[model samples]
Target chain A: MARTGQVKKVGTALAGVLTISLIAGVVFGEGTSPAAPAAPIPPVVAPAPFSPECQGGSTEIVTESPLPHVAAALMKRRTVRILAIGNSTGRRQGGFTRQIERLLKQVVKGADVVIINRGVSGELAANASLRIKNEVAMSNPDLVIWQVGTDDALAFVPLDEVRETVESTVRWLKEHNVDVVLAGLQYVERVAQDDNYYRTREMLRDVAAKEHVMIIRRYEAMQFIAAAQDAGGGYGPDEFERTEAGYNCLAQYLASAITVGAFGKGMSARPLRGPPGSQPQQPPQQAQPPQQQRPMQ
Target chain B: MPRQSNAIDFWRGIALITIFINHVPGIYYARFTHANYSLSDSADLFVFLAGWSLRYIVGVPDRPQQPIGYLVLRLGGRAVELYAAQILITMIAIAMLAATATILDNPLLLEWHNAAAVFYDPIFTHIGLAALTHHLGYFDILPLYVVLMAVAPVFAVIDRYAPNWLLPISIAIYLITLIVPLPIPTWPVEGQWFFNPLAWQLVFVLGFVMAREDGIGGFVRRHITVLRWLSVPIVAVSAYIVWNRMWPDPTLMPQPRLLFIADKTYVTPMRLIQFLALVALFSATYPYIKRWALRLVEFGSMLGRNSLIVFCVGSILSLAGQITRFVYRGDILVDTVVVVLGVAIMAFAAWLPEWREQVRLRRSAQPLPAS
Candidate 1:
């Protein structure tokens, strides 16, 4: 009797299941395979316009080689090669690495600069250090522009560890005789107010000075622009007024400064100041015009 | 078993409340003080809770007969209710819009004035379509809930027949959804879409499986400390990534790859892990909070019991409050008054239906010896 009861229960449950399935089928099965073409696959290589900056110097483009085990390739009687490695910030259209490529191409004049962007967002300094050999060395570029540290600051990686990581990275590049440009990032908002930004910047600066590699004062340039805007009566209320313009100006300044600092003399010769020792004082030069002088209102 | 897992429902109620707070449009404590909490995070939590709750309520062994039928009815009923509610609310919104146009003498909603052009834009049209389809508004979770619940039986069968293969299948599906693109259109072009099912299903599955396990409650208790400690780094890393990537653009459309990876649409891996971390942290510290909340006695239990009613009414009230904002034109005091009054009125509205039902039940229970 008990066995029969169990069987009856199971049968009832199965019947219920079938009924539910039928209902679901009726509801969701409508247009189950709606007529449409397959989605288009994104192109692997997006068409990028070459910049006018890479025309005058010995510019090395670092990118992944197409054919394996080919150190240098002759494509239509011109060598095509590139080295790509860094974080997501390095992979943007206007990111530091791309800017470097544009400038390098402009300096070399008609030399095809194949700059590869291997920047994955959210990568930590430790991860970069671990992957340096495979991602950077394997590419075998003549020059490497290593832009990192943003993730490290937010990750709370120790200042010493950040310096050690960068130092080792530079050493590895130098071992392969790969010229290195160690780029520094500047403060945007809260980061500028915090002590960690300055500490990280100083650590990078010290490493660059010790290693005799090129140091780009990206942070100082940002401060200069921010200070200039603040001095000229505060910038607008929105983020675009505050950081977008600042980031663009800073990025432009960094690219130009790195090129100048590494290869030749340009605007980078100007003295770079550190973060304010205390709360920022009112700009030494105040706003002049009466129209601009409206009180805090 | 009669599915002795009401604990998850309590947690789900809390998740729903968080979602309600997130959907409240105007500036509140969440805006100025805790702006870091994204609307996406709330959606992820809700999806996870939904999956978890399904497993708890429906997938137990030695269960009642007609489980699948019961589940389907419950889901279908909720969907129907949602559609009906949305139609009513949309009409109310349209009416409110028309009334405001009259009061302001703006002619924004009047077809003759041609100011209806703005009102007839995709924002309203899409919301209108959503209402018609029973999809609710952009922030509505009911449509996604309906879809997820419908699929639960299939998952349950897989759980029963091939338990060992479940995790691998789920992970494979999740990875495919993550790497491969699935383009689903959401309305308003710029308005937020609440949840995505593809990435989100993993959380639901995880919750479902965890609920089925014999030692889940004990396991949670045992690993509380380790889980709490682990949450710190997880939160920090996720926050850093979100701050760097998400804050730059708050708009819903033209979503970047990071948003896809975050996957509020269908509970992506990152969201699942983050939500689990949050749950762990909360459960570990819940004793202190439970003690305090319990101290409130009558109000706490009443609020907890009628959470669904509170949520529905709260949502409608928030919309009313938003309309008042238009009427008052950004007067902070007036907005606050409107919101407070809206909340009271909604709470009262929720009480009315229940009161009527209670009265009917009392009358039905009256002695009928003469009859």
Candidate 2:
């Protein structure tokens, strides 16, 4: 009996030691080092329009044209088009697509900014590829703003699949001469308490870089707004509205910049400046002759 | 035999009730639901109890073949019943999805149909393939239980003949699972299954081994005295550990590498200790709780005796509650009220058949006494 009791005590002690050591080893091991104060994440910055002369191409100005004369000619010749494709969040009436469309209409006015919103909610990038040709390519879009990766993240899509799908989609779009603007995923702080969303966003950024496509940096913008709201106090109905508005502003900023970059002097003359208080004012809007707006067929 | 005053059923009922509430999303308390106390955990607890009860129902040493066969048949029948229940629930879920998609003008089905290729990938094709080798979802526990039961006979033999070896074997299995890497491909990702059957088997087998102890009653009596004193400190320590583990200083994030062990997968050594400590702490106090639990268990056992009927009815009621929540969107108060009423109706349904049988038995036995 004494020997048995001693053995039990020894087993208990050994269990305790083993458990403690294992925990210590893990807690003290590689990942646990105090994350070096993350280099302060740079705030998202809108791209500035380049001067027409700096574009390394011939510049032409058509006067009293219903569209930016240069862009009007390009549109008549069927040159520049843009497509927005994503899930339901992208398709909402007041969602990213509408905001981008409104911004394009305002900025490029008569430049024939054909913005198509082909967003189906809950659809991952994998499915988007299936219908890409008919829905996106048929328009012969010169630029495609891709807002995906959220549904894929929520659905537990493997990181590699996410990378491969985005890569293949980018390759396909580029092959068809469509300039790709990979829209980074919005932050899902609530569901992503486990850091899954952050990981997905990082992967998306990596894909954008690897594919050599422009990135809209929506993830950073959303995180910025979310953090600002949190700092100001707490979440409320108004705050949610403000966050949505901020996301819209982000979409507008990215679309306008990419459009200006792609079409150059052919881009419309509307002010690139957002509504008052939308973002930190950076540069003065360049002046151009007003052009009449025409309804898109 | 009269229903034993086993608190096991009460605990089971509580587990089920908690799980029912946890599944009802958008509740005020929804955010607080953790892996330890959710449906998967409840299933784990149920399996452990099933193993324990198997030993209890069959004699410890060598039981008669007839009784053994009866027990096996009962358990197997229960498993079959569960499978049928799962199939029914799946159909109901599909119907609910359809209705919600149509009435809410939601594009959920359209989206699902469009993404069928991604959604319909075989379980093994995904990460943690071993984990997803079984169906992927919150409702896959029944299949796991069925698989576990097929091996229960082997476990029964060990329980009956080599009881002392059970703990060592279970410990060895758990340690191996901890030390060795088993990457089970799961849909969308590769990781271990939620329950980590290898690690969890220890608890089930421990329960089985405990049920066979000859001096359980005496042990309870003695432990009850010590438990009253020890429980306070144990609880305090447990609480402390939980707080420290979950809410460690934000500064610790920089050293995320160091916190790799904090991950719950693989039953990390700390988590194993914490969970075992909780179980031991709770078990030690059982004697004091037994008096009240005994009576409740009698009530619960009466319901649990026909658990299949109760489980099926309970699941349907729970589904109705979920559908109601999905339609209503936000009204947490209404959701809670409806769920509570639904649970009551299920309990009553579970009770009626057993009550009627009891009455019939009493009447039949009375006539024999008069004769």
Candidate 3:
């Protein structure tokens, strides 16, 4: 009985030691390392030329940010892998990934753009952050286009939770050498007056700025397009039909945004105006005249 | 005769209730569910108990003697029934979403829970939905259950003939899946199933092996006290891990990373092991629960007896609760009302069939004068 008691004590001590070791391993693990090392910045190049189908005259769809990995992949292997993720907005822009691939191919003269869409409907930012890790493990993309904020606004997820989840996920991605572009909310009629919606959008903008990544500023773009078309009397009776058109136009804008983000060089670190009266963080850069654009192939 | 309230049914009923609450994404009560603090949630309990319950149908000694072919046919029919239930609930859920969208004049409602394909790409989405390749989020588990039931006959065959081989074969398949990460892909929406059946089959097999009276199950029953004592730290540490949200980065992990992560879709080793420890620790609670609250035991057992119908009803009610929360902005009062009414409706759903069965039994037992 005494021997058995001694053996039991030994087993208990061993288990205690093992547990402590596990806790230590978890506390000071691989994730503690800082993301975004000081790698030399790639030289800027001309933004990929837009397709004739892309509209919204000279609107700066993406703010100035460096996509060094995408540029390196394009330069060395002539290939870039992109993952489009987030809420239902990822699905709303039909065939936008194909358009991005096509435009990049046209511009880079043999670029192989591989895009995978992993969008879940009505997913909040926190949940999407978890899924992003799983998908990155599986897909190994060089760039992640995250359409965010709208669902969180609608679901009333805490603003702090949104910020923390997005910031940490963005940092995690950067640490793993993946570039990110945050696509902000859509401009739906129902949420036009929602303070939470606007705040969530602004919060996302702040996240992009703090992270030093580009944001698509989708809400501002959509708002500009809506105001321009309405003033020009381009309305059919069906507003849903206009939403479809808006999504199509959004596709073009996203494709352009990806192009500018991947290849645009020497862009000042400033936001640009989409149309007159739309929000811009800096003095508007004059949009190149329509005549300057290359005609559609 | 079977007891009015058994551990299996009571625990299954508990799982059903927990699942109902958790399915409502942002409910006030959602924070109170086991998911908030445990590595394994009701889904694991539901699936494990499902495997445990199947031991009776697999021609064990305690079960009445039945031919293997009959058992196979019964299991096949059950698989078909689960398939039908899945299709029916999916149609109802879609209609609910569509109705809400039209009533609110909000197209975004149509986009909720991966229903965009059904609205925008109806032709292919319908085929995908019917084939069980397309599933709405929070409405997915039935497909996994269907697959498990479909394969149960094969498991039973192996278990009956070579009992020792069943677990090792299941573990081999699970390990292979984790290494290769060969998930069952979703159609019409380039993705994978939320609950990957290949990796999940191991849990089911474990539950089955532990339910039997020979080999593993008998050994476990004989040594349950020691196992329970050993499980305490595992359960405690896992709860701490979940509470503090200490998840390892999947990307930094070595190859065969699915084996290391705490992913629910693949049901990783951590989750599986923690869940088994949880089962070991909690397996002793039912008798105490019965002693303290007999009414609760009876209520849970009733719900467990008609688990399929209750689960289907609970799932639909949970979706409705989500919609309710969305409409009302999810305060404490709204959550209370949604959960209270939803659970009541689910209980009613469970009771109705049993009441009808009892009625039929009484009529059959009565002597007919004219006939």
Candidate 4:
């Protein structure tokens, strides 16, 4: 018994020494380090005014003709900051934000565009809505592009609940004098099957119209692209929306809308793709004079 | 079962509850779980404890006096039950998602968690799911568990005859998988399993090997007090590491980001070490905790006793909570109600088996006057 006790003591001591050394080694070894910086998104060249992807103006500018706040910042400061918040759509794998920045750089001469991503994959808009206020306050971007409703649509969240969350969030953004842009859902083949997908899309459109904020017509443009794709042999057989090409196209559409909205009718006095809900025709022949988009405030 | 009152069951129950909340995306109560404050979360704990539980069934120093074939068969039977459970639960989840999707008129439900592939190509995907090549989101861990249990007997036999080489061999396979980065691939989506068994088996082996009282488990048990002291700083530093998102960035680390990154799929070394340190510390303090705390052991013990059943129900209930949060606006009150009701239901599910056992004991205690 005495020998056993002595052996146990020896074992305990050896174990203690070993553990202490292990802990010390780990504690000192590779101590806390920071997350690697986000990949540098190279600013590339701008797309043509009417790429196959751009339809009229993919986004209908909601704030009055001149985006005075963004314009003022761009013209005087030659710098504009945009906060892109959403789910997987906002943080596309191909660096959609980089494409947007490059296009905006082309649109605004000698101007610097800083776009920040505030997206979490698989995050619901309801959750995003709760967190947006803090993000906006921290980043204080000139414009906030909120990609919403896709996850909610997928999660089986109620339509009214979706509307209420969005409508109220938009109201808060507007009240804070943050120019809000509601980017709609991604269009996919499955979307055709889901009634709530379009229901959520329409609700966003209605909210944008009601609040008088700009919204990128992402779903409609993607639908147009998907239809064009079905006509055969454009961008391979992959789901157009899931592909990198789809995200780049989206970036082009959104960038074009922002440029048109920011610079006013003077630069491109071009005709839009079509008037809101007009005949399904091609781009207007002449660059008609656009609204004198000064800020409503 | 001399009315076992170990901390394993209690911690496992906690892991179960935490997993249930975290599985439900966008739940208000999720942030309160261990993941926010640690590199490893409840999943790590659950898997580790799972491996530890295997030792109780069959391992050196305390293995049951059963024939090797019987042991193999017993483990095989468990694997079969788990496989069946996986299929049944997966189908139930599908039905639930389908019902919600149809009610809300959203086919997008099929898209989340790669379920869209199943719906889009049901015949093939169903075949894949049955064959254990495909797994659904939030319903994945069980498939991994099934694989581990199936593999346990081989390790158990090796453990009985050649314990020294068991862990080395297991670690070698783990490291090889990491180096080659081999993972069991999933179908229809063209991705690998979320919890890669190749990588996770390391934790399982470590847990099992460390549980044997004649080996490291004995050493640790003997030196638990000193190790517990060492764990204080380990836990403190780990908390800071997690909160600050501090770790050697995976990209900066040498080859194989799987080994370097803080990932759930691979259970990276950083997460593994921290979790081990945590278990070492926490397990040592279990006895003292009971002196000062609530009936932490009793409720969790009951739930832990029937962990598998409770887990299945808990997972289903968690989905229901998410749907509830969606259907009704998510707020403090709504979140509170969901969590409260969810826990209550889990408790009832856990308590049912225990209640039945207690009633049997009471009846058994009654002297059979004529027997």
Candidate 5:
């Protein structure tokens, strides 16, 4: 009798487990896969033309290599998701993330652009690297625009730690078939002479070159803009006001640079079609001769 | 200070102190925290202990369970309190940052710890803050606690009616979440919560389950020696992995990648498992700890007993510490001063209420001295 009761209890527990699993399965399994993406809508407005003040220093906008995955996704699916990580991406009015989305839509015509802005304020590169991996797993973004170096530089993090973290993370992203755009430190006039600041910038430049990824040379662009503004007249605005304008110009530059990187060899080879509102175009910027791809050790 | 100090409270106090130290990012002492050596940090202990404490609130074996409606209301009230606390402290933290920014004339202070949104997009960010959709870094855990508390009644109902089904149900939800990307998304910023409650609920449930006298609790107590022995290798190996920073790449894992990686956001299986093992291994050390460090044990217990308030004050103090460190350029001396002062204040914050309660108890026992 005792043995029979024990068997009956075990049977009951097994039945309960199966019932719960089935219920949970039915509920969660229904929406595990996202809805099939809608057909691409033709962009109604032309890509925002580069602000003339934001223009110039054409070399700063160069893409060293193509973002093959972004290009492929745009070709095949007509949709691409870009995860923007860093402290600086969260400027007042949706910052560069919104600008990129708008520019990509206008630039690519029918390609759908989704920018997942995962920027946290005061985040260093080493910390962002960890969060970037998980965000990649969850969001499955085709490209990541990492606004790195600024916080690390300010925090006085060692250059080697920054390099190792960025290099390893970039390699990891590449291995996972995701493209990366390293947006280097934001330029501030006061920090121009700081050794740590310069070292962080140099480190990022090195990582981008070493990893064979496109880098947004924000420092060089901002520096050029600052000099042009100063020569044109007095210091353009107070430090705070200039920071805001700097962010706007950064958005414009990044939109152009990222679009160029995505379209890559294709953009250079074809006769470029200018957006309706912009001047009849030359290729967005002087494209760097493509570097030979090297395998990461 | 509370007239009694127990192991759970002592451990909680230790976790609180660790959290306080870790929140000041550049503090030299931060390197010495359990996070440096363990896969699971104070967060795991804090959340697990939250679940363990929930067992007391819901019911005890010897005490009659409160009426179901009253129980639900109690949990709801607690959730409200936590929510209120989150809003209050977040506001104060922002104010502190803003004040520091103004005093120093450095606008960068406004950007620290995801506070830019609160200033930049105040209207939407305030709405997000109130709705618990936007959270600041290092100040996010409470929102998760509020959410877990809000759902406590369901766990209670399940435990009441089908006692055996609770853990299985929690596990099912956890597994389903692992397979499906069902994280609660953040708003006003397109992202997921830093602490995904769905994945984290399992640890809380495990804590609750293990705190009870029957089921898993009784089983654990009975075989604790053997389990402790088994946990030794998990703890030792995890320590080595963490110390060496041998964490695997999340993207390299197969589908349901979250399950394989040692991610804190999702409180992945590896973290959850290691946390449990660490708990198992450490749970036996209370007697030894009391023997050698009774003063430390008492201090930790006092802090643990008033965790919510201490945590709130500690959060503000840590933010202040961060600002101060930034201003001073964070040398050893700056870090030392920030840490020492911040922790000293936290201790006082914890002690203040207990002291008040003790006075109240003394007055009540004095048989209305004025009359």
Candidate 6:
């Protein structure tokens, strides 16, 4: 009797387990082989004309090689998805994320850029690192543009941990056949002198060099623009309202890099501001190429 | 302090402290919290302990003397109180963020945690916020707690009348909800609630059911020694999995990914299992708690005892901590001072209830004739 009761209990438990499995099989089995995607339709708006402001200056922020997947999609389907994450993407209204999309449509031929901005403001790198895999798996984007390092710098996350986390995350993206672009360290004036800010910016540059992934010099780009705009400038608040102009400028810069990097060749680093503290000697700027007209808004 | 550990209060206190640190997103000490090694953090402990407390207060389902209607009213009232508390905190958080932005001369602070809603679409977002569908970051958990509270009476009745069937039904609902998603969608945003009450109800129900001395609870008590030994390996492996970032990608998993992966939002199976194993190991440590540890536990107990109020104050304190960090251009010294002071305030908040009771007693003795 005792043996029979024990058998009965085990059998009951197995049935419950089996039931859960059977239901799961029905749910996932149907979802696994997704239907074939519809043929791509060309976007409604015309691609924006290229802006001279984006022509080239900082070769450091430009992509080194072609984004193979994006390039292929551009050639065949004319459709490409980009996931923009990290803290600064949606900080401003009419965010830079949308600006990047608008610019890409305006510039790239036979290209449709759909950007899904999952930027949670004030989120640290450690938290973002954990969420990125899921975001990528769900969307399967061709490129991930992460505006990183700002929150990590503010949070006092150890430099080593920040580098390790970013490297591992970038590695994970690569393994999963997604290209990553690291947009580093928003140039905030308050923390400009803080070691954490400067160290984190340097660490990202080093990570980019070692990992060989493209790292957008958002900090450098902003600093250079502010410096050029101000006769004597070095990372403090410039005469320009930082948020509105900064978002647009960063978008324009990234858009230009993506266009050239996807279709043409990598940009050469034009030295600017001469390594931070040195007296400004009119550091070579990306002067007008003459063929280009008004800068794309 | 010298007696057997009050496991619930001790753990609740621990959860409170951890929650405070975690809420201040960029604090240096936050990295050391339980989330570093485990899939679930203090939130899970908090909700679970809430369920346990309700059961502890109401007595076992089998021998309840109070009418079911009264029990329903009490729990429903608790839900109302929590709703009020949630709204109070949300409004305060918005004001705090707004003031921070003005004081710091950085309008960007208003953009943090979706506070732009207050400036742009306050009416629509406030509707959602009041309805408990929209939650700001660091101010989310209370709404989830309120939703859970609203359903406490049903849990009580089921646990009492059909104790054996209670867990099975709750688990079945949870499993189904995980696949189908919640019936109601969040507003001012087109996604589900961050802490979906449907899925999270399982842990809450689990805590309630397990707190009893009969049914599955009795079986666990009988086999606790064996279970504790088994849990050691489970906790150890789970810790390794999270600490090493060895999580399997949930998207790569089959349907019912909630069961296969570790996620915080839905309280997925992996997270639930890992949390349970950790609890199993720690629950047995009451007797093993040293005298020195008890005093610390006692402080935590004070906070835990008056959790609702302390938690309210703690939430505000967390936002304050964030603003202070931003303002101070934080370093180790700043982070240390804020964390130490923040915890000290929460402790004082916790002690106030008992302090009030003692004052009431003394007043009653001296002032009856005058009254």
Task: Tell me the deviation in Å of residue B19 in model 4.
Answer: 0.7
Candidate 6 Cα outliers beyond 4 Å, as residue runs = A1-46, A49-65, A73-81, A88-117, A220-245, A248-297, B1-5, B25-28, B57-59, B116-128, B157-165, B180-194, B248-256, B290-292, B326-332, B365-367
Q: Cα lDDT for residue A158, model 6?
A: 77
Please give me the DockQ of candidate 3 compared with the native complex: 0.22
* Residue A261, candidate 6: alpha-carbon lDDT: 42
Clash pairs (backbone) in predicted model 5: none
- Model 1 scores what on Cα lDDT? 0.46
For model 6, how does the per-residue alpha-carbon lDDT over A107-161 read when each residue is reduced to its tens digit?
Answer: 5545678876666656778778876776675566888889888777766677898
Q: Is candidate 2 or candidate 4 better by DockQ?
A: 4
Instruction: For candidate 1, write residues B1-371 as lDDT tens digits.
Output: 11222345455545544455444433242343122542235555556666665664565544534466676566556556655555555455456556755665533123211112224343555543553321223225555554566677667666656765665787777677655534233332221233555555677677776665544534766676887899878766766765543322112223334333343444545566777776676665545656666443323333334545665666656555544543443345764676557546644654566677788888889998785
Q: Any runs in candidate 1 off by more than 4 Å, and if so which?
A: A1-297, B1-13, B32-40, B62-67, B107-138, B159-170, B187-194, B213-222, B236-267, B295-308, B349-361
Sorted into a CAPRI-style docking class, model 3 comes out as incorrect
lDDT of 5 by residue, B168-279 (tens): 9999999898888677877675656878899889989999999988789999999999999999999999999878867776777887787888788789898888898999
Candidate 1: tens digits of C-alpha lDDT, residues A251-280 = 443334322222221111211222332222
- Which one wins on DockQ? 5
User: Where does the lowest 10-residue lDDT sum fall in candidate 2 chain A?
Assistant: A1-10
Which digits, one per residue and each the tens of the lDDT, describe model 6 over residues B218-285?
88889888988988888888888888878887569876555676667678887898888788888887
Compared with the real two-chain complex, what DockQ does model 6 have? 0.15
The full ranking of all candidates by TM-score, starting with the best, is 3, 5, 6, 4, 2, 1
Give model 3's TM-score versus the native structure.
0.84
Error of 5 at A99 (Å): 2.5
Candidates 3 and 6: which is better by TM-score?
A: 3
Q: What CAPRI class is candidate 4? A: incorrect
Worst 10-residue lDDT window for candidate 6 chain B reads B183-192
User: Weakest 10 consecutive residues, lDDT, candidate 6 chain A?
Assistant: A1-10
lDDT of 4 by residue, A186-256 (tens): 77665565577778888887887677666766676655555555654243545523344456666875665
Mark the regions of model 2 whose C-alpha exceeds 4 Å error after superposition. Answer: A1-297, B1-5, B29-44, B62-78, B109-136, B183-192, B215-234, B241-269, B280-309, B315-319, B359-371
lDDT of 2 by residue, A1-297 (tens): 000000100111122232333344344533444665422211112233322111111111111111132233344543346676665333223345555655555444444455655544445676565435433423456667677776666455567877887888777766665667667665434433535567887787677656555565555444444444454423332433444444554564454544333332222343322221133223335323223221121
